[model samples]
Target: MESKSYLPKDHVDILPCMAAFAVVVETGSFVEASVRIGVTASAVSKQITKLENILSLRLIERTTRSLKVNAEGEQIYEYCKLVLESSANIFRVKDKLVDNPQGLVRMGVPKSLYATCSKLIPGFLSAYRDVNVQLVCGERFDFVTDSIDVGIIVTEKPPEGMVARRLFDVDFVLCSSASYISKVGLIAHPSELAAHSCIPFVGDLDKQYWKFRSSHENCDVPIPGRYLSDCPEAALTATISGVGVSCLPVCLAIDALRSNQLIKILPDWIYKGALQGTAWMVYQPGHHVSKRIKVLVQYVMADLSRLSTTWKLM
Candidate 1:
């Protein structure tokens, strides 16, 4: 098939405006496009208008209620996607010449990982002084369509169509404040948990059964709790205050365990099979991998490894 020709060489300077026009078409409004592109609505509108003028075509029919892309506009938008992507690749190539990894690296991580890694991220930025990192912390798996460069997720299986690298395996343990254990009595076995007041993670409680395995035996115990919360931090805080025993990621409960503020229950028993949680570093397979992304991934993997070891899960 013969390829359709684009505009004259002189029109190349309007590439940014053309890109903006494509975004507006896809988003159906200048305001939405502006939000996605991190630009003002007025600026996005002006750029789209400029592109329309350059092409001498009414690409979009705009009204107060809606914006519709014309046939020519749709074609241009399709071509512009390729053009903008190629242009971005050119800039990325040129950017690699700098000695330091420098650019914006947008990363998505689970809220729990964010809390633990917040302290370590600054060290990475210090090492690559030119790089600016944007960390979006959420529990939802929306990283792929959200344009996230890297996603740190805890899952048994990776999301479809993404490249996933195993970062680490996380272990969960039953933990309680030392004072609480001392006051209510120490829990030496899994069955003893039924008698203690427990703070269950509201999000996972419906899945209900907690499993444990020792050298010779395995058991899945039904868990009952007096309090429940969706936030891991809140649950940890409640456990720290001696409210109840909670099943927690060992990493998150480390400091309390070391200071004798929290005590682990049934140390011989393992939960959730061999893996309590699997941390996977995932990214879109064909997306551009900039130096900043490469460095950030390496740094995070190393940092998480160090943290995992410190938590005695190595």
Candidate 2:
């Protein structure tokens, strides 16, 4: 780790010295080199002195008012020029990558959102052939720990220190198959659910409840059922098959509802429970986002905007 270990005690480092030496040679004057490097002329002169002392060679011949690189300095300057060109090329390649939408983007998506996000990714990849996507499916994710480039999160407000764009509100509707409703006989109030076969989502145990909100009041009805599942799509499937009544996101059931395959159980009441929030696309805040991530966010946001309109009609 110590550069001094490779040289004598009094000898200074080589890279900085070489850089200063090369600059002085190319500019032809210590003052001009110092200006280009944003340093004082004396500092540049000191670097050249340290470099000469380390090499045990006089690389420059200078007088009170004139300066010139000798034959030895000229030879070393050629290698220095190559080093400088290599450094410049490295930065140019980095700039090209940052400005181009071409790389793998890792995205974290909640499990239930598969029905929504799965539809958008293929089109994005088709439109930007050079870009690739890796979808990480889960209920929750830590962007830093998980190395997620962008993700969908459901919350009342966006998490702190993240750049977020609201996609839509996370809402659900109480629905079941028309055959199940006819078999059980239609009931008017939310309390009637207690007597019927009500479906509980995956984690519920002992007791399950459903919240209902109307213009005048809110109700919490106890849900009693024999079927349980974690996936929203599965819940919609079970409800469509007349297994029981379940609360499902409108995005997942809008098409079925439109086709009369499923009917809303409480049309006048909106389900207002744990699943309510504004779904947002969040990523780490930075001065410059990578082009791959930027394009993915833009594409997903636009697609979600169009999809949200259909949810309203349902």
Candidate 3:
């Protein structure tokens, strides 16, 4: 004695069929609808048949040569048209974003690479006026918890499940201010460092050795720290201020070396210390990358490429 509901219980399951029905109605041929929908004509016929079975109504009258929409089919076609339009609008929004990107793109950067990363951001924002960048500078980064869109890290091997672009190799070299070198005299060999006031980046006591490698041999000097700091930038600043000879990344020390503020010691030897590897710009891999992040990555890489030429980072 109760009135029955007309709509199917699993209404959400029929969206694809509704879309096919709408396309078929518009095209007036199953083969033509299949072309538009990127499916076979038989597949389109099956979807229509399934839709009719689900609703328990014959929505279309068909013969070998002719096809016609019944009264119920005509009513359903109106609602189906709306559904198709709504689906199209989803992709249209993405297209608009791609053409003219506008949004916030958060970047995670380590302190070691902060100077280089920060310098490029202003130019990126100037070019993309609608997009803004937020630099989350730290020693380490968490992609999910930090909501980081992009990150720059120094590592021998980049983490798995990421898209990594190697910017440049980080080369560490022992350098000191010209004044400090003049006072301490020239270091001809690795053993000479032990005699001079050394600034080792000792966050803890365990990292006390500076390993030097030439093409022919390797030398490990145990550093007795007259001045020490964990941060590379601090060590760099101290060395430039004539505090003591400290190991510094070449990219960090290049400008100083060119300006003759810092003098490179033991030029034949490579610093085989803890901080050594290539710096990579990394992001999560996905089929659909946002326009803002995509443009930013391209812009930053281009800038770094130009810098690498001048800095000889390659």
What TM-score, computed on C-alpha atoms, does each candidate reach?
0.64, 0.83, 0.73
lDDT of candidate 3 over 160-278, digit per residue (tens)? 99999998876777889989988878899998888888887653232578888889989888888887666767888888999988887677788988888898888888888555778
Q: Give the TM-score ranking, best first.
A: 2, 3, 1
lDDT of 2: 0.83
Off by over 4 Å in 3: 1-9, 24-79, 102-110, 136-150, 155-166, 182-188, 192-197, 201-206, 215-217, 224-230, 283-291, 312-314
Question: Model 2, which residues run further than 4 Å from truth?
Answer: 1-14, 25-42, 54-58, 63-79, 203-207
Pairing residues by index, what is the TM-score of model 1? 0.64
Q: Write the per-residue lDDT of candidate 1 for residues 1-314, one digit (tens) a residue.
A: 55436755657678888788877877888889999989999999899888888778888888898888888888888888876688789888786744457878788877556668777789998998889888887766576577788888888988988889998777677788888977988677887776778877755533366777899988877777788776667889999999988888777788888887788777777766323578899876765667778888899988888777787832
lDDT of each: 0.78, 0.83, 0.84
Best by lDDT: 3
Query: Which residue pairs does candidate 2 place in steric collision?
Result: none
